[model samples]
Target: MIKLCLQRSLRPAVLLSRSALDPAVTVRKVPIVPHIHSCQMGTRGRNEPREPLNSPKSAKDFIYSLHPKERTCLLMELQSFESIAIAQETLQPTPPTRAQIKYVLFHNSIPFVGFGFLDNAIMIAAGTQIEMSIGITFGISTMAAAALGNLVSDLAGLGLAGYVEALASRLGMQGPDLTPKQADMWQTRVSSHMGKAIGVTIGCILGMFPLFFLSDDDEEEKKKRKAALTAPNA
Candidate 1:
C-alpha cells in the first residue's frame, strides 16, 4: 500500500509516506513540488524565496518568521504593489464645474424651443380644420373638435421627435466639458428643467401668430352663432 503525504508551503511537496505492499517491491522516496504564482511580487532576486500572502494574519506571521535580510526584500516587494494601486486611483477622471453645467442647459433649451412652437401651431391649425370640416357637419361641439385636434397633434409628435433629435444633433452647439457623473447631478437636473420651462413658455407665446391673421368676418359669424344658440325665443 502507498499512502500520499502533502506538504503545505509556497511550493507544495507531495511524497509517498508508505512502502509498496508486495514483498519483492523496493520503495524509493520521491518529492514532487508544484510551482504556482498567484500574483507578481515585483522583481525577485534569484537567491531569495517567495512566501504566500493569503490573508493579513498569514502575511504577518510569515513576515515575523523571516530573517532580517529576507524580511526587507519582502517589504520592498509589497510596497511596489501598494504604489501601483495608488497611481491607478490618481489617474481616474474628475467631475466638471458649475459654469459648464450652465452652458449645457442653454444648448438643451434651444431644441425644445422649436418643439413647443411646432406643437402649439399644429394643434391650433388642426382644431380649426376639424371645427369647419367635421364639427359643423356632424353637429359635434367645439370641445370635441379641440380634443380630436390634440389627438392628431400627439400622433404627429411621435414621428416628429426623431427628426427633431436628428436636426439638433446636426446643428450641434458647443457642449459642456463635463464628466458624465457630474452632468447627472441634482444642480444640472434643476437647470435642465428651468431651461425647458423657459423655452416652452417663450415658444408658446410666439406660436400665437395664427390668431393675428383671422378675418373680422369670421369673428362676427362666430358671435352670431353663439347669440342664436343662447337666445330664449323660438
Candidate 2:
C-alpha cells in the first residue's frame, strides 16, 4: 500500500484526488484587486490650471486677505493721505478781485469818514480840557488825541466793512442793478449806515458838552488872573 500511495502521489490527477479526498484540506476565496488607470492617478488629465491661494479677485478681496495689523496700518495710511489732501485744499488762499475791493470801499467810505470826523472832534474837545487842566500846550495834546481817535475809527471801519460784505452776501445782492428782492437789502444797508452815522455824530457831540463847560471855566479863570496881574498899582 505504501508503494501504491507513493506511485499515485507522483501523478498530478492522483495528487488532486488525494487532496480532495483529505478531510483536513480546505479552500479560501481569493480577493479581487481593481486596476487604477493613469488618468485617475492625479490632475494630469485636467484642462484648467489651479488658482493660487494668495490670489485675489478685487480690491475688497485683497484687503481681506491681509493680516489684521497689516490691514489696519494700510487703512490708517490711506486716511492720513486723505486728510492731508483735504487740509491742503482748504488752506489754500484765494485772492480777492479788484471789483470786490472797489465795492467794499464804495459802500463803506461815507460811514468811515463820518465816524472819523466825529471821533476826532470828541477827542479834540476832551484833549483841550486835559491840556487846560494839566497846563500843557493845546496843539500837542489835541494832535495826539486826534491821531489815536482816527486810528480807532479806522479799525472800526475795517471791521464794519467785513460785516457789510458778509451781510450783502447773505442778502444775495450781487449785481449793481437792484431788483425787487434786493430792494429790502439796499434799504437795510442804507438804514444801518445812516443810523450808525447819526448816532455816533450826536453821541460824540453831546459827549463834548462837559469838556466845553470845563474849558470855559478854565478860560474865564485865566482871563480873571491876567486881569488881576495887569491891573495898575492900587
Candidate 3:
C-alpha cells in the first residue's frame, strides 16, 4: 500500500469522501489564486492600448524577450513626457486685477495746514512768540492755537500714512517689509513739511506781538507832544 499525504487547504476534498484520495497520491502544496489588476495608461508616442504583462504569460519571460535598445527607447520616451508635463504645470498664469493703485490709496489732494507737532516745534524753535514765549500770554493764547494746529495736522498725517501703506500693500509690498532706509526717509519728509508749515504760521503770529503793546489811544499823546515842540520852535 502506497502512503498518501494531503495538505490542510485540500481538506475539503478529503472531508467529502474518505476513499476519494488514491493511496499513491501526495499533495504537499495547494495552488494559489493569482491576483489580476488592469491599468489603462497612455504611452509616450502612441495613444493605443498595449498588452498587459499579467495577461497569459509570466512577467520574467516578457522582460527577458525585450532587446536593450527597445528598453532604452521606452525609458527615454517616458522621461520626455514627464519633463513636458512638469514644464506646463510650472508655466500656469496668475489672476489679474482691474483695481488701480491710485484708486486704492488717496483720491488726490491733501491740505498742508500748519497743524502738526513737528511744525509747532520748528516754529517755536524759530522765535515765534508761540514758540518763544513760555510766559503768561503764550501759556494761554499760543498754547491753544498751537494745540489746535497740531491736532488738525496729526489727523491729516494719519490719513496720509494710511494712503501710503495701502498703495504699497496693493503692489505686493507689505508696509512692515519696507527697507529701513526707505522708512526713515518717509518719516523724515513728513516731519520736514509739517515743520515748515508750523514755522510760517508761528512766525507771522510772533511778528505781530509788539502791536499788542501799542496803545490804541496813542494819537492824542502824539498830537500833544507835537504841539509843545512846535510852539517852542514858533
Off by over 4 Å in 3: 1-187, 206-210
In order, the Cα lDDT scores of the candidates are 0.56, 0.43, 0.37
Candidate 1 structure, TM-score to reference: 0.52
Q: How many Å off is the CA of 211 in candidate 1?
A: 1.3
* TM-score sort, best first: 1, 2, 3
Highest-lDDT candidate = 1
The prediction achieving the highest TM-score against the true structure is: 1
Residues 81-123, model 3: lDDT tens digits: 3334333443643322223222212211121222233333433
Q: Write the per-residue lDDT of candidate 1 for residues 54-167, one digit (tens) a residue.
A: 555656655555565554444443333333433334366444566776776787787677667777777887887787666655668889988988887777766665566556
> Candidate 2: minimum summed lDDT over ten consecutive residues — where?
36-45
Q: What C-alpha RMSD separates each model from the true structure?
A: 24.4, 41.4, 34.2
Per residue, candidate 2 scores C-alpha lDDT tens digits across 164-187 of 334434544333332222323544
Better of 1 and 2 by TM-score: 1
The collision pairs in model 3 are 115-149, 115-150, 119-195, 124-131
